[model samples]
Target: MTGWLLAAVALAVGFWSYGWQGGVLALSVIVFWLLLQFSRAMRAMRRASESPVGRLRNAVMFQSRLKRGMTMLQIVGQTRSLGQRRPELGDDVWTWTDDGGVGVTLHFERGQLARWTLDRPADGPAEAPVDAPPAPAAPPPAA
Candidate 1:
């Protein structure tokens, strides 16, 4: 790929300018960069694991902060938790829901955010789920 080609070119340049010593220096720099990237990912995952999966505190605020082309690690870092996978739609589809019944669905391609949508609760008061216990009946008015 292009990255490999650029690395090769850098190695060649380093060797051409200062022989083996330059090559070693260039390789060390490249390794350090890779290590830094790996460390960043580990940090993000650690932050994400502290919270419950697929849950958000403020879905609306998260939506507002979203930007196209964000990496999955970046999204995880922002949300502070892993999204719930939706593999039925596609391999990279995921969603997060808030306590208010709002949700956000996101689609990622090549590990970068391709598109996303915010799903809000429908108009009208919230209703309990079908399996929820029925409300108690009110007592008759006193005479």
Candidate 2:
């Protein structure tokens, strides 16, 4: 859509320039616009393929925050479903936008409890505490 709009504008300018020069100027403008669109699309495709993990991480973080907000609703009991829904099950995700304009969706099951946190990545390994104390021994049972 954007490409078409750009092409239309370029074509108009080229047609206007044709009176002074010739059809060559118009043709050049059209070619330039086409090349620009092609390059923009290629760059977008490259970015999409380069860092899929990073993209997934960002989405997880966004959804995690949304889940936290839904937790406050007090839905009771565990969730019956979660995650992206299948076509057969119908769409079961709710979306909201954060202050920064990032959109997030929290997927949930029918009766399950769902929660999100804005800490680390959902798949990232947790770091253990350096000065963790040993477990305490249980007291003897009544004799």
Candidate 3:
């Protein structure tokens, strides 16, 4: 309502000062700016709808925060992709960016959790599901 009132006032003033031609030009400029703003908003919404991008729930964001010594299963259960890019999961390193924009990095050694960190990359990767093989069996006992 306020914006409309302001625009009306501007239109009236433009006509009084410079006649119809100038008034219409001024109004066109205002309309152009509004259109630009609308376009940007729609674009942002469309992108978000396509993928899990932009703002997210706090709990969902924390799922990426890995604790030292967490199993691969536990880590995967926590970290999730924040946007188009998903968390990259590997036997050696697991990387992801949470909704809050914080990076969750988990490094493993021989199927054991080695390190956990937070480092957002320029381009984050999608979350990788963990499917680690069972631990190796112990050697047979001597005769």
Best by lDDT: 1
TM-score of each: 0.80, 0.34, 0.37
Q: Can you write out model 3's per-residue Cα lDDT over 96-135, one digit (the tens) per residue?
A: 5545566555577776678765555567577555886767
Count of backbone clashes, every candidate in sequence: 0, 11, 6
Q: lDDT value for candidate 2?
A: 0.45
- In the range 63-104, model 2's lDDT, one tens digit per residue, is 533433344133111121223323453344444333333434
By TM-score, the better pick of 1 and 2 is: 1
lDDT (C-alpha) at residue 29 in model 2: 72
**What lDDT would each prediction earn against the true structure?**
0.91, 0.45, 0.59
Which predicted model would earn the best TM-score?
A: 1
Following a full C-alpha superposition, what root-mean-square deviation does model 3 have from the true structure? 17.3
Residue 19 in candidate 3, Cα distance off native in Å: 0.3
Ranking by lDDT: 1, 3, 2
